[model samples]
Target chain A: MADKVLMKGNQAIAEAAVQANCEFYAGYPITPQNEIPEYMSKRMYDLGRVFIQSESELAAINMVFGASAAGARAMTSSSSPGISLKQEGISYIAAAELPCVIVNMVRGGPGLGNISGAQSDYFQSTRGGGHGDYRLIVLAPSSVQEAYDLTMNAFDLADIYRNPVMILGDGYLGQMIEPLELKEYKKPANLPAKDWALTGCKGRKPHVVKTLYLIPPELLIKHNIHLQEKYGRIKKEFCLYEEAETKDAELIIVAYGIAARVCKGAVLKARKEGIKVGLLRPITLWPFPEKIISDLADKAKRFLVVEMSMGQMVDDVRLAVNGKKPVEFFGNAGGWMPSSDMILDKIKELKL
Target chain B: MAAIGTAEIVHAVNRGENLTFIFVNNAVYGMTGGQMAPTTMLGQKTTTTPYGRETKEAGYPLRVSEMLATLDGACYIERCAVNNAANVIKTKKAIKKAFQNQIDKKGFSIVEVLSQCPTNWGVTPIKSNEYIEKEMMKIFPLGVLKDKGN
Candidate 1:
């Protein structure tokens, strides 16, 4: 029998991490997401797991990088400003193909914006916040259950892809409490001994895991091509989305994360008023359900892109639709969350 | 003999098994253009500061050693200087103590090596050392803020 308990989103994620056999957690405390590190500090300390209250976000992510490189299931989390600070290290993690989970309980952005729920980091997460031709397996969780489940899945996806996976949540999602059936904790499989870990050579060959390939232009290009191939494979196999009331719908709303939750309410209310509204929530924002959106574009006359950021995901919607349907965007930025009523009004205004 | 500061401190901390941190309180950035750092002195001047740093305009430089002292992980925290050979020896002792603390797995340790940034001070290194001995020491008194005593 699954153990059901009421837990805050942040606590759920922390618990899920422990269940997933994450042995190392290094992070600095930030608002709207402090519960994660705080919980980890107490729980992990009791469990004799390594937890470091890192000096800075830079230090925290790098510590995670080190632990993950050493073949430990490691995680670090932060809000917007801290996540911005971690971009450089995140890029390093991706380049080295190290598996690690990064949770961004996103707040307002562009600067030290605010401690409010915002999806402004959609582009930052999916498009690779740092400089690179790489993509993180970005998972957007819309509910507290997902906050727990996705965090567990994040470790698996990260290990499977050997790429960084982000559990993108908003401040509201982080703060909200919900009932969750906790999954059984499974010990991670023994990782094949890799030469690259910093463990003592112990009479084995020395290993180097570095992204600096300054030898030749052709060699660097070939490495990039190989990474691209991996990304291509991920795009095909890992793309996921949830469709709500798509059959016989004229207007399809495309949203993700908390915004999707709001859109669902709006869609339901609009349905009661005789508006044929449906929702398409992209679960994996990077391997964005482009094919699904393209197929919907054929039947849906109008598409509305809703987000907490000002139309960041709209670009992707436009690309997916490819002018097959009229795409409209509505959003609130810098920590402002649009209410379900406002979203309903927008859908009504679009008059599909 | 050689001296080190934040750059050397971070490098050593990252590389060495048991390490210490030494911070200098010259009240200036002391590097490219001497603007201000987290530890810039309250009233100091540099190329960027035509007038002395106004308390209202620019905030005071933080005592980094004291900050590190508060961390539960940190073991020993002390502030010392190299204004004179006697004080330099004292600073050396503090650095050794910090390293010893870490070697004992006591915790993270730091030693503030309050020295002078003469180039940014617009003075000779000798004059800067003298200024540090006379002025800076008065503001940032040297002592062990935290000691795990391991």
Candidate 2:
């Protein structure tokens, strides 16, 4: 058994990244996630790793792009506003197919939102925050334990998929303190060699990484098709979810990240009162666990979608359920958390 | 390499220890079908600025090496024109020195080359070279902006 140590959520993710053998980390300081860059700043130098507190989020993401192009596990993290600034760079990384981990500890806002926890960036992270037909593998962590585990796994997943993978968390998920069972950093399953990396072309042909394919429009379309095929494969193979007491329930609640954590409590409370309720938590937000939701739609009479936003993931839930079941939404915004009472109230509001 | 914002370049110059940057300046957005760039000369006519850029409208061309030379971490900052045969030799020497500085681990260095963009400037290649030797040289003079070793 690995020794357990209590640590801040943000600090745990930073430590987990370090354990993942992250060769490079570049980030600009942003709220709730500042501890990540701070922890990396202190430890990376001693550990012979590269850490740069970049001038801005844009610069940080591009630096990660350059490092990742040179064949290293690189990462950059920011909050909502900072992540917004990194969108252009993220698009470039996606266009070039550079593998890197991007962490966004979501805080409130459409613009310059406050530095409190919020899940308002669900669509931003899942539905191509940047321009173009792109998809990032988005992971939602409900606890500090998942934060550590996901941060570590994010590096591997980023490499395996050769695309950016995001750890979509809120401020609370990054600030909460909890004991975590440390796992040894293992290399990702079936990570291919980065032979296409820009390694100076010393022994092979020079590798060029760019999004500009202008001489022939057809070439750009072909590149886009290639990327789309990869995304399709990801959708088919990399969907993950966790079901709690959903086997025999007639009514189910769907939530993710911290909302799920709080909603689970509400589901248990509803069960004790003889209300048939269960919870479905989607770990991977991009490949939104539609299979389970659609399958449960066959048995469950109603679905209550919970979020810390203005009804973002519910669109996907509705798409998955395909009108077979009544899909309802309960939202909270402006850094307000969805409490158990609120979720329970919403369940009762469904009147099933 | 054709057109880049100065923000990222400034940070890279000041923060990165051993990186050699070759900044090719053609005074216009050459790759983007000759749109006006931040480094377009005061009176240069780009596609975006069809009436010839005005001081009130477009400001002035940025001397990138001079701006970067202000940073303490910038080891070498040279602006050379590659217009004529003799100038080409000097420009090559400057580029070699920039790369050598990185290998020597001296510090960050950038060699801003005043090259010609014939297609974007809507001129013959020969005429573009002459433009670099004449118009471009006045706004962006060929000289070393900063050198830590010297």
Best by TM-score: 1
lDDT of 1 by residue, B1-150 (tens): 011133444444434335555555666545423544445555665433334544543346556666555555556778888888999899888888877777776656777788778777878989988888777777677888877665
Candidate 2 lands at a TM-score of: 0.71
Colliding residue pairs in candidate 2: none
iRMSD in angstroms, per model: 15.8, 17.3
Enumerate clash totals for all models, in the order shown. Answer: 4, 0
TM-score of chain A of each: 0.96, 0.98
Q: Name model 1 segments beyond 4 Å from true.
A: A186-196, B1-150
**Residue range with the least summed lDDT across 10 consecutive positions in model 1 chain A:** A187-196
All models, DockQ values? 0.03, 0.02
Compose the digit string of candidate 2's lDDT tens values, residues B40-135.
Answer: 888777654555666554467767778788899899989988889998999899999998898889889889999999987889999999999888
Candidate 2 - CAPRI tier? Answer: incorrect
lDDT of each: 0.81, 0.86
After TM-score superposition, what is the CA distance of residue B81 in candidate 2 from its true location, in Å?
44
